[model samples]
Target: MIEYGFRLPSSHDNRPLKFEEFERHLDKTILVSATPGKYDYEKTDKKNIVEQVIRPTGLVDPIVEIQETKGQIDDLIKRLNVVIKNGHRGLITTLTKNSAEKLTEFLVEANFKVKYLHSDIDTLERIDILRDLRLGVIDVIVGINLLREGLDLPEVAFIGILDADKQGFLRSTTALIQTIGRAARNVEGYVVMYADKITDAMAAALSETERRRNIQIAHNLKHGITPQSIVKAVKDIAQHRSTKLKGGKKSDATKVPKEERLRLLAEMEAQMDLASQNFEFEKAAELRDEIERLQAEWGL
Candidate 1:
């Protein structure tokens, strides 16, 4: 099985699965990450570690800057304004959920298409929020910790890290690097760390970022290449999954009225039954999850 996310199970609080049992079923594994943790490194030899430092787009890593924490939110707004004028997007990471919501509110009042993401948001809503950001429906997304890792927004040119000097897991070296990675896909990617003082974690993260940036720059120079931003196609979720569901069409379930939602859920149930009868277990499982997600979103 291919493990998709960059984060290992140990990094998070919740235990979704027993790692022992997970490994027992594994004959072999290909763990991928920009920064490998101790656990994954221990599982493989040094020779097995493959470095893919060169992005196909030749996009370099972001230039990280430090700013004072005082009035940092306003500074972020100014930076985001510049990014917005350039037809790009920004990601903001605050120290708490309250701050995330407050920043999002302030930005919205400033006439920016903005939203906040946190643990409080439901899964389907989170998906919709991300999709909105990708489609340029929203120009900014504010989050506490979730924006740090596994968030791939190629259009994001600016990343603002509030309270970067705060000594905690959220301000750790690993967290800083991961957050910075969100901007790596864009040609104009840049990170602004709002902190009065540079902590050890900040120092380490900046140094590593600089090291990778130098390597990438040298490769580009040697190859006579110019950097370009990544252009990723945003997939229509329903349409993308429909191919596996046997000619199923797109669902506007998220946008429909309550009555229409119920009708769509009923239709999905019929499709689920057909998938099960066809011995398409995986497709049936996906339909089941989609049905449940719709139910949860609509409070059915």
Candidate 2:
């Protein structure tokens, strides 16, 4: 049997993973990310690396502007107002959850339609919050590390990165690049770094962004094309809620015959393993949770 999987190079604590042990089990590997992390650079073959620079939406990369961090929050608010007036949206990433919450409050007081997202927010609310942001119910969204990746916001015209000079995992070159990519789907995309001094991370991010921007500009000019923002419709959360309810209506594990219950448990465990091997951690975690729930029902 063959197995394949993927993981972020860093752990939840922001330390590098011990890949020596992991590499022992694999014959081949492929590393993928919008901004490859340090481990990718150190371990992967540079010649084998694949670069995907052209976005299907034909959106040009954002213009990055460095601003003083002395009055970062106020500075972001002033700029976001212009984005809102233009019927576009803004995203702001701070360094901490407290900073995110504080900024959200400040934006609310300023009468801007805004919301803050973080690990503390419940899963259901996170879905609703993102849906609302896309639907224009909220003009601005604030987040910390969560805003760095897997955020698909096509209406985002501006990204305000606070504490951009702070050196660490949050300000790493990879993190900065991922955050900047959030604005890449919009025609009017732009990134504003609230920093007094440019760090190595910022410089690398700027250089890469410029490279991609130039390529995109050349492509647009050659094709006689105009950049356009993507418009993705918001999906209703109620459909997911209904699906959850239907899936929860399974037969009680304790009520099933012993042999059948064991068979079901075995099947689920196999699926969980398959999910893990396929690098679908979220699906694997869900299956693990379901297994535990079934075990509890069976009084195991």
Winner by lDDT: 1
Clashing pairs in 1: none
What is candidate 1's lDDT per residue for 174-204, written digit by digit as tens? 9899888889989998999999999999999
Off by over 4 Å in 1: 1-32, 41-50, 238-300
lDDT of the structure predicted as candidate 1: 0.81
How many clashes in each candidate? 0, 0
The superposed Cα distance between candidate 1 and the true structure at residue 35, in angstroms, equals 2.9
What is the Cα-based TM-score of model 1? Answer: 0.71
Worst 10 residues of 1 by lDDT: 244-253
> What TM-scores do the predictions have?
0.71, 0.74
